[model samples]
Target chain A: MISTHLPALQIILPLLAAPLCVILRNGTLTYWFAVVVAWLAFAVSALLLQEVNAIGVIAYKLGGWAPPWGIEYRIDLLNAYVLLIVSAIGALTVSYAKPSVDQEIGGDRGYLFYTAFLLCLAGLLGVTITGDAFNIFVFLEISSLSSYALIAMGRDRRALIASYRYLVFGTIGATFFLIGVGLLYQMTGTLNIADLGERVAAVGPNRTITVAFGFMAVGLAVKAALFPVHAWLPNAYAYAPSVATIFLAATATKVSIYVLIRTYFTIFHHDFSFGVMALGDIFMVFAVLAMLAGSAIAIFQTDIKRMLAYSSVAQIGYMVLGVSMATVLGLTGGMLHLFNHALIKGALFMAMGCVFYRTGSVSIESMRGLAARMPWTMAAFVAGGMSLIGVPLTVGFVSKWYLLLAAMEQNLWWILVFLIIASLMAIIYVWRVVEAAYFMPSSAGAPTDIQEAPMAMLVPMWVMVLANFYFGIDTKLSVGVATRAAKFLLGDAS
Target chain B: MEWPGLYNYWIAIFLMVTGLYLVMAPQNLVKKIVGLNVFQASVFVLYITMGKVTGGTAPIIAEGIEVYSNPLPHVLILTAIVVGVATTAVGLALVVRINESFGTIEEDEIRELEEAQEDAS
Candidate 1:
């Protein structure tokens, strides 16, 4: 009986745990409680994915009310896949957070951090599961608002400014999304996503729908940190506490991209969106720019966190490039990257978190001779960096191979060239850190007594690193799920 | 163009643009929050306007009332308004912290100080 309600339970478990953490009030208690809740949420999502695979789409009505009147939680293969990624990352990050949080944020504020982390996790899950358009906005705010609190809790005063800027950008993006939903409501008279899918085609091409599409596209693009509107990301990632950086880097923008995919292929219908509207051309231009520019900027950043953050921007470009092709292979590539990049980035940031736990800084200068001191953490960083550069044995190479095939399938040879160039650029930035850590002498004023990050941090960091290799070799799970989900998204769009 | 018939939309557009300008143009943190509130209020107006029906009364069921405005959009906006208020509260709290740390809420001055701190480090 309870198994039937796993979808709702997936969100409720974390949502309830968030407030419970606050009421618990002790830092250590809240941390352990949060870890348990996160792991349970992860288990629930694993079961939810199993259920989705066993019996097609699962639509659980809120309060037993039918759709088009009450809200609904619809889980197709695509979101089920994304839910697994988000929840898995959330579990890993929550488990990894305690030591990093204690080091940077101290014990007094640890409960609040765990509370916000739980809220953010619940919100991301809610955004993914809900079939209602307005519910996405509400859950989006729930996540966004908590994340601002999380980002602001960093020890750096600049974290304050970063959080504030993100607030402004994030609110505008969400309001733009709200505007889009309002316009769609005005036209379709329904808030259900499946309901909108049917009604939107009948409404056909109109000014309101077009404007709504534009609003939603731009809004979600900002949230996704798509190149030009991505000014808030680097600083936000750079200044946030290491634990927060790892979690947000892994999941926040990926969820935004999931919504973007929903809007483009599902509601608007790929026929209207890609064929008539020619959105692919527009996205292509920006995606290429993001690839070239984000990577170029990363090469120059002294701060390793900011460098990886910019690399994230470039990586988002790769995902968008796959999306713009609008082929099944292309969408598969996009979806796979969405999963793979989360692993790649989650592992990379965890390694960085380990570094930050030991060294008080993540600047390149601070990293000189780091490899000699902290061999295990440095080894993890190098492995994750190789993945970022698309080394053949890593998950990044698998996604890139698919994207290259998709580009070839479309006869878009220039995209292949750009992809290669971006990978080469990844090599340069990753090399910079490797050289600093492995080859260069310790810099003046750099701490000489740095040690390996503790077992609490190392175990989770290595788990992520190993998953990168494990998924890379066994493409059966990631590739199979992505291709199935892609086919479903394209075929299932009404 | 329907002219006066779509006056509410015109008003929404105007407020939205003004609010957007306020957010982008101002440097003071407090002003930015105010701008954010205004921007959110514009969305609230947009949603509420979407719910209105011609010659419609309140959505409460009655013996003879047939033309009632849709209550769903109103409900959604109520939630949105609560989110907006929460955002404002958080924004204000950050501004307080920013003031305590940086000693100024002006964006330019803050940036300058941050740059100096970066240089010194």
Candidate 2:
């Protein structure tokens, strides 16, 4: 019975703790509360994953109300995998947020910071676990609102502007999504995702359905930071507090991608979405553009955080490219990249946070001779950077391999070429930082006496860095789960 | 084409396009927020329009109510309105902060200041 409630508890525990954090009013106490709640949520997610694996789909009706009438918390392999990724990143980032928060965001606002963080975490989990169409929009707003606050909490004055820009774009995205959902509800007269899927199939493709799909796809693309609509991401990530960057970079867009996958594969049949609509072809075009343009822009950014933010856009393209392929191997690659990129980017951003903790700057020029001073931090950065480059023996390599395999299976040689070229671009951008940190001599005014980041920060960073290699070499867990989830998504779609 | 039956949707579409245009075309941050509000309000109307039935009364228990309008979209809109209000509040708060720091709420002015700062540094 307790295991049955894991779906609800995963969200409730964090949601309740958010208000408690604000009530506590002490910075350190609130942080500890967040850490405990984050770890508890992670544990609950792990339990849910195990339960889903042991049995099958675990559906828990909210308030004991039956389906098509009340909201449901549905945990299939796909949901469980995403839940695991989100909470795992949440736990790791919260553990590392303490010193980083104190350094970057000093003041009595720390309690509020933790409160917003917990709310965002809860919202993300809610979005992942809920089986209702309307619930996704509600949770999406919850997370978006809290994240605006979190981004604004940064000490930089520009943070306010970045947060505002994100708010404007994010609101438009959510509104578009609502219109799509409203159209769907008008057609089907249901809000439950499973029931909607059945009804949508029965109704087939109509003008309303086509228009709804367009709105939802475009809306989710904005949230996921797809090419041409990703203007808000770099500034928001570059200027947000370090901890916020780490968490958002790791999980936010990944969850949006999950929403996209759920909408296309679960709610709309594959034939209607891909065959009739040709959305896969359109997605492929955008994915290619994103990979090239994002990397090209990143190569020009001087600030390390901004560079990583642009790289995130490129990395998202890789994942979307996999989904667009619409093959078993392709979906598997996308799913694996979803998990692997979280690890890769989470560790990379955490390393940047540690560097910022000691040096107070994240510009590439400021990191001259960082390898000599903050060896551990720079080392972790190197490891994470290698993973970003998709080097052999790293998780990134595994994802790209599957993606390449998928492309090859379709005999899409052009896509295969683009994947390789994008990886080279990743190497170039990541190498810029590597060269600055390792090879270049320290600037004349650079601090020679700077110390390595605190053990607390280094520990979590290394854990993720190590995971980049560990999961790379031992592909059993991530690859197996991803392949199974992909198969589940592709089932009955044709 | 039946003008009355399709007119509601046309109005919703017009409002949606106007709101979107304001959001895209405006340079003032506050004006953009207003645009966002109008955009969201259009969605509220759209949802409510879908919930309407010809000659239907309110979905309240009565002795002789044969056709009642669906209430779910109304409930969903209520939640959405709350989210919209919260977003507006947060957006305005951010604008206030931007004004305090940068001394102007104009997007062009702020961008100029940032570019100048970048050039100087």
Candidate 3:
């Protein structure tokens, strides 16, 4: 039955709707259509997640051709959860984009904005659901291409330069990923991920495969904004319009982090993950570095958006560090962090959009006394930021709790110390912004009397913020699912 | 050992590296777009080369030789190429806007202006 392969349709519907959004040629209609299609994709992803939870794994072959020979869309517990996160956030973000897009982009270019948004969402989903190694690269380009367009659509002239810089970096990342695939394909003569895994196991100690792993690790490291290689992220996120920043900041790099986990742990096996270079140590080192450096850099930023961008780099470090432990608990922590951070940051970024909507500027100094002016918006920021700081009752805390436990399990006491220190750094930066908003003197003389943003924005913002808190308490949807996915990703290796 | 044996992959590698270098080092925006094209073209060649049979011809349905290059990579690359072109066009379009707004086509100069603006504020 065609219905059984709902995982494929979760990606396919939006993939089909992207071009339709373009051809429809009306910004408002295209906007609504994209939102609908995105939600429809979310619905399909939820269904698929349920099926995966009940059953084992779902692999749907393209055009009735079996895998390793034809394209395959594989959904296990891991990807099914990712599919749900990506599609749900994408749908809500698209609805939020409608009014924000209309306010930012002029009438003529609005249609293009929605079109590119849909394409990017579709591409992210495609990358999430695909089982083939090379298809990952293909879908990566789909998302990257649309992302470049979306970034460039910013009204600010600096956006073009920012988009170009991002293009250069993004292209490099993709090239590196491709070379990795090519090298692997050369050794194994296969492009299917599962088949490549099998053949790679046979080849065992081939230098080519090791080199391929290096290429992919670095490529994904850059894409995920692991510090030092994260130069393109701050400006791209800061300069792009709020909608683009929110959508990408929430989902894109997080997805790359997922790919890194999948390729390293699932596809390559734990032996490869721990062998040769003692990769676990290397990852812990870099992840800690990212954590410290990102927080320190964000502390000094005057621009609120750029600060969040740097914060994302730091958060990515936690996820990578979690994965670096190379155990079930570690994998669970990292995977859970990925989901938790997405929710918290997604909510935070949406809150920033509200601030931008009211103030039309993202300069932190410009937002003095904004807490009094737009209390709801500022409150959302505080909520998300508390979650970001991993307070006792937030999703961020749950992620951190798991990570701390994982570190303890590994008996890496220094890592535990580093995590605590890094979180203190997070508190410093977050408190800076909160102090400015609530405590700093009103810079605009009378606080500028800026009203709250429209319901179109606030409702979505609250939903994400509330979800962060709600999921923090429940943990069943996020933790239960991520725990299952973690077992799946590490099960075979373990 | 012949013209298309291992030589094809070597060519693919060469093109791929060249494209990557171009994008990395270029100062002008349009050159970067061209670089992205070459990079994607190289990927295309890799996929196409991988699809070849020992003595195969095109993948048409009526191939009497019973040897046809795999069509999957070609199809996938076609979609990828289209995506590549879309990205390039958008990059160039952004460059055009950059030209209009900043009145400069060079990355260095635009960066100078931004730094100056940041300092001025």
- Candidate 3's C-alpha runs over 4 A off are A444-447, A492-494, B1-14, B42-80
Where's the lowest-lDDT run of ten residues in candidate 1 chain A? A485-494
* Residue lDDT tens for model 3, A340-456: 888888898898888887788888787788888888999999999999999988999999999999999878899898899889988988898899889998784444668988999
The digit string of per-residue lDDT tens for model 1 on A150-211 reads 99998899999999999999999999999999999999999999999999999998999999
User: Per-residue lDDT of B1-121 in model 1, one digit per residue for the tens?
Assistant: 5657789888888899999999999899999899888889999999999899989999888998889999999999999999999999989999999999999999999999989988876
- Angstrom error of the Cα, residue A279, model 3: value is 3.1
Provide the global lDDT of candidate 1 against the true structure.
0.93
TM-score of each model, paired residue for residue: 0.99, 0.99, 0.93
Poorest 10 consecutive residues by lDDT, candidate 2 chain A: A485-494
- Pitting candidate 2 against candidate 3, the one with the higher lDDT is 2
TM-score of 1: 0.99
Interface RMSD of each: 0.5, 0.5, 1.9
Q: Could you tell me how far off, in angstroms, the CA of residue A329 lies in candidate 1 after the best superposition?
A: 0.8
